[model samples]
Target: MVFHLFGLRALEVWLYSRLIRSPIFHQMVGRVHRRVEQIRHGIPPEESRTKLEGSGSLDKFVRYFKEEIQDQMKGKPRNKL
Candidate 1:
């Protein structure tokens, strides 16, 4: 799931914001949270190194995942399940 969609930066940010709650924290805190998320989630160093790797840009990844989710919903009809 992480590879085909939900790319590194988005995953890292989700983990960080879900785990941390300090409005007055320093920038270093945010960086540390991101690193911690990456380590905890076992994201490869090379994979997390950039938003653009191979042919998939971050925007493209997000758009693809959104479309995939929409298609899945259309097929499964969430309330039916």
Candidate 2:
């Protein structure tokens, strides 16, 4: 049973890797990211839907995610060791 579960997990990882490398996957992520940005910026959902047609590269998505994370981190108080 353990071996079977491990095999399934390995297959999932392989499939995920391939999916991320595909242009289609990146494009889909890009679209989602753009829609999220529009909503975050207070754009009306009706307008955002029409503006969802745009291109996004994996690099841009990664950078945007990183920036968001950093900004969130900056707003919280950190404990010093």
Candidate 3:
């Protein structure tokens, strides 16, 4: 039973790793992120859709992820107990 559980966990991890590594997955995540941001900024849904549709380049996607990571790191308190 323990071995079976471990095998299942390993398989889950492998599947998640592959999914995360896929470019299509990144593109989908990027789209969702942009949509959320636009909504948060009070952009109308139609306008947001148009803006998102115009900005799906690979370079923009990479830069977006990089900026998101930097923004996240900036918000953390440096010295946790």
User: Model 1 — TM-score against the truth?
Assistant: 0.27
Candidate 2's residue-wise lDDT over 1-81, tens digit each? 999999999999999999989999898998898789878998755543344344665567688778777877899644424
Misplaced by over 4 Å in model 2 are 43-81
- Ranking of models by TM-score: 3, 2, 1
Residue range 1-49, candidate 3, lDDT tens digits:
9999999999999999999999999999988987998789987655443
Residue-level error in angstroms, candidate 1, position 75: 0.5
Residue 65 C-alpha lDDT in model 2: 74
Model 3 CA deviation exceeding 4 Å by range: 44-81
Clashes of each: 0, 0, 0
lDDT of 3 at 15: 100
lDDT, candidate 1, at 38: 80
User: What TM-score against the true fold does each predicted structure earn?
Assistant: 0.27, 0.48, 0.52
Give the candidate number with the greatest TM-score: 3
Worst 10 residues of 2 by lDDT: 45-54
Ranking by lDDT: 3, 2, 1
